[model samples]
Target: MIRAALVWLMLAAPLAAQVTEPDGFRMDHYRDPVPETVAGGATISPEGAYQLWQDGAAFIDVLPHAPKPANLPKGTIWRDKPRHSIPGALWLPNVGYGALAEVTADYFRRGLTNATDADPSRPVVFFCLNDCWMSWNAAKRAADWGYSAVYWFPEGTDGWTFMDYPTEQVRPMAPQPSQ
Candidate 1:
């Protein structure tokens, strides 16, 4: 009986920490945006948000690359995409910058390494598909990495495309300085 009881205790240990009193348990930082209640709980119009991004609001597009089969505005601006997309945003993928479900400590470590090594004033944004969870998770990961200015662009490519914003095919590799 004592052995069985010991086994039960061990099983319950992990569960205990995972459980919480409903009222005392709130994950404020990880919680969804307290939607503009006036505009409805989960849906925020993109007009305002897009303007904010364009106006130098640091943002991250979730896709490691721009949308496949790109549809974007024509002209010189459309060809060689800017590294700091949308004026001042940095491009960082939410899914560890590797293959799907590739998030590991190393993935996170490299992400932070790359981010911190860049301009500190750069606005970091994480994004993915419309209404997807990857960006949220990525943004949280970025926050965990001590990025004070992380933002999540939930509207994603769909929002950008629908609004007629230009998107590049895929950002080109940075040119190596000539030896």
Candidate 2:
């Protein structure tokens, strides 16, 4: 029985490691972390997000930006296909994890200011893909920046799409270089 238990423990070791491992680039593969609070904002459901939207909350999409093609031939017209988000959501790609950096943080601040018209009291919701941490981090950043009302829509674009909500195609703005 002891030998059998040892074998089982060895088998479970790798699975335990996998569970605790930090996700690098693939943020959409795991389940959302369960906590009463994230950063400084509270997690919100899709229905809650819908209500917030109806109440005139600003929505920010914090999905990672697709990398530019490295070796496009000269004169090749390389336009990005329009990306879709929950209707009225501003596509602020690369504002998730990158916002942790000082330069990117400045950019996020500016974007949030413009999105909320510099009104710190305005309600703001942040989201990315379902199960993604980018929105969580961004929402926290907003709260840290002294925003009065900040929320994290953990259900993200996937959840919104799953609910058959209407989406609008949007063009992403180029990020300004960090000064």
Candidate 3:
């Protein structure tokens, strides 16, 4: 435990200097180190998220699904990668992009409503992968959308799995238009 704390302290300073909270959504490099804090929302760790999950907080997974390339040969077999996330988490693909199309924006708004069962006061947790900015963007968007309780799990599935937390296959809240 002491060794782990030492290592983290050594790495945290250099990394802390490099990532600044963005004024707006991160427009690119979705997979990168993220800032430690997000405005208008709370940052949570795996244990905290687990406690909330136990309490039935709404969890939203904003990891985008990779689609098969249109340029692939007609007969080439393409298999979609599977996503396993925190149990009961709503999988809303592509909503984590820095910018949103009208359709995607609508979907996100509606998904939140549906996921929370129209309870605007329900605590919602947003997450993607470890060191990913997508979750940060989503959490901010949720807060801006007036979600009364919003939490950002920056470590996401990577952290969850690291804790040996149970996970299950999750599909999109609904069919998502390719972003």
Best by lDDT: 3
Candidate 1 lDDT, 9-36, residue by residue in tens: 9999767433221222123332233221
Model 2 pairs whose backbones collide = none
Better of 1 and 2 by lDDT: 2
Off by over 4 Å in 1: 1-45, 55-59, 64-121, 171-179
Q: What is the TM-score of candidate 3?
A: 0.87
lDDT of the candidates, in the order given: 0.48, 0.77, 0.92
Candidate 1 has what TM-score? Answer: 0.45
Determine which window of 10 residues in candidate 1 has minimal summed lDDT: 34-43
**Residue pairs that clash (backbone atoms under 3 angstroms), model 1:** 59-125, 60-125, 62-127
- TM per model? 0.45, 0.74, 0.87
Q: Give per-residue CA lDDT, model 2, range 1-179, as digits (tens).
A: 99999999999976842223232322453345533356556778889899898888999998877766989888878777667898888888877773266767777888898889999989999998886777776777688779978998987888888988888987675578557
Candidate structures ordered by TM-score, highest first: 3, 2, 1
Whose TM-score is greatest here?
A: 3
Model 3 residue 130 CA deviation (Å) reads 0.7
| Model 3 lDDT per residue over 3-117, tens place | 9999999988777656889999999999988998888899999999999999999999999988679999888999878899999999999999999999889999989998899
